[model samples]
Target: MSRIGKMPIAIPAGVEVKVVGPKVSVKGPLGKMDWPLEEGLGAVVENGQLLVNRLSEDRNVRALHGLARAELSNIVLGVSKGYERSLEITGVGYKVALQGRTMSFNVGYINPVLFQIPAGIEVKVDKQTLINVKGFDKRLVGQVAANLRAIKPPDVYKQKGVRFMGEVLRKKEGKTGK
Candidate 1:
């Protein structure tokens, strides 16, 4: 009865999907992703589309029905088009630069913070502030972006730090002038 679960995920060209028992593996040009089916949840490939069905009427099974389907669909999409997150660095003299496999951040520290970029993920810096994080796996892409953002969360007063593009910061007013 879940609206999302009722929808079928289409298999695009150059993408191969396999359903083995409770595990689903999708191989695409970008990469391969695998996930296990939840209890009472069943999925199959039919007519070039992935169909998700619930084998039981339990509430928990029903709840996971749609979520599992959506997550699998996301994986398909990720392998096809990939995922990307943009972050902006704001502050005086605050910047980021990439050196081969490592990223250097100049965020108010005497020494730049160095972070090694993970495999399958690409990090690009522009104008020393705008950062673009990209990868085929949505989960990994998002996690890397979050880790980069957490390195220097935005300040309330100056709003100076790393933040996702389009993210709003609640700026605090400066002290009243005497």
Candidate 2:
């Protein structure tokens, strides 16, 4: 038995979980999300908790057991409490602003870079340097933050660019003149 798959997911208040065939639907105060389970894996709710079970003991079936459980757990938690990712901008004039549904990144570029915000995800800017990406889907929230960070990943030499909040990077020293 898979350790993670054996663990039951606790359903918080105001959250509703439904298992329909291979699809799992989770709804809570934040939002609702639906996802299909992997083949040979099934889910059931009992005693206010959700459990993932495998139909067979094959190697592949065992592998998907934990994955299905984790995915379902993420969906439940996301809908109940939501998820957020924060990014910090470093370097002079490397700030961001939200214009309508787009993000304007001014990271020492001739023209500010632009990123369009997707539906179901919200972006909040604080004083132009800090950014908050929020949504009810953990994967989407993380993907959005990663895309924003890719705009100008941290510099190895100057350590300037967009990075996750509290991310530590070692600075590479420049070549010394002979």
Candidate 3:
């Protein structure tokens, strides 16, 4: 038995969990999320908690047991409390702005990069250099953040560009002239 899978997830207030066949839907104050159950794994809502069970002792099933539980827990938490990722621009003249559902980037480029914010996700800019990505789905929030960072990844020489908040970059030494 997996330790994480054996644990019960406590359903918080204002959060509703519904399990229908191979699909589980979690609805909360923030939003709603649904996940498809994997093979050989089962989920049940008992009392005020959610439980995950595996139908076999197979190694693959055991591995999926914990993964399914964690994914469900993330869905529950995401819908209830939400998720957010912050990024920092570290170059001169680099800036970001959020207008409506579009995020405009001016990172030392001739033409500003425009990223259309996807549905169910919110993007906010602060101090012209800080970006905050918020959403009810953990995976979407992270992927969006990664996509934004990929626009101008940090430079190895100056460590300049977009990076996750508190992320440390090791600067590379430039070549010396003889």
Candidate 4:
């Protein structure tokens, strides 16, 4: 039995989980998410906990068992309490501002980058340097943040650009005259 798959996902209050055929739907205060399970994977609720089971011994089936369970758990939790990722800008004059759902980034560029925020995700700026990303879907939230950060990822030499809060930037030393 898969260790992670064997574990039951505790259903928190106000979160609803429904299993129908090969699909599982999770709904909570924040939003709703659904995913289709593999051919041999099944889900059931018992003792107020969600259980994931695999119907085959195939390597591929076993591999997806745990992964699917974990993703479902995260979805439940995310919908209940939501998810967030914080980012910070580090530079002398680099900063960001949100104007009516458009992100204006001034990262040492000739013109500011105007990014249109996608639906279901909220971006907030503070003090001209801090960025807060909030959403229900963990994957989408993180991917969007990564894309934004990639616009001008923190540099090793001077550590300028947008970066996750507390993320470490390895500094590089300049070559010396020999």
Q: Which ten residues in a row have the lowest lDDT in candidate 3?
A: 54-63
Span of ten consecutive residues with least summed lDDT in model 2: 32-41
Pairs in steric clash, model 2: none
lDDT of 4 by residue, 1-178 (tens): 8899888999999988999999999989999999899999999987878999998899999999999989988888889988999999989999888889899999999999988889989888999999999999999899989988998999988878899999987899877898
Clash total of candidate 1: 0
| Residue 133 of model 4, lDDT score | 93
CA displacement after TM-score superposition, residue 137 of candidate 2 (Å): 0.5
Between candidates 3 and 4, the lDDT winner? 3
Residue 26 lDDT in model 3?
95
Highest TM-score against the true fold, candidate: 2
Candidate 1's C-alpha runs over 4 A off are none
Clashing pairs in 3: none
What is the per-residue lDDT of model 2 for residues 31-118, given as tens digits with 9 covering 90 to 100?
8899898788889999999999988888999988988899889999999889999999999878999999999999988999999999
List the global CA lDDT of all models.
0.93, 0.94, 0.93, 0.91
lDDT for 72 (candidate 2)? 89
Q: What's the alpha carbon RMSD for model 3? A: 1.1
**TM-score of every candidate:** 0.94, 0.98, 0.96, 0.96
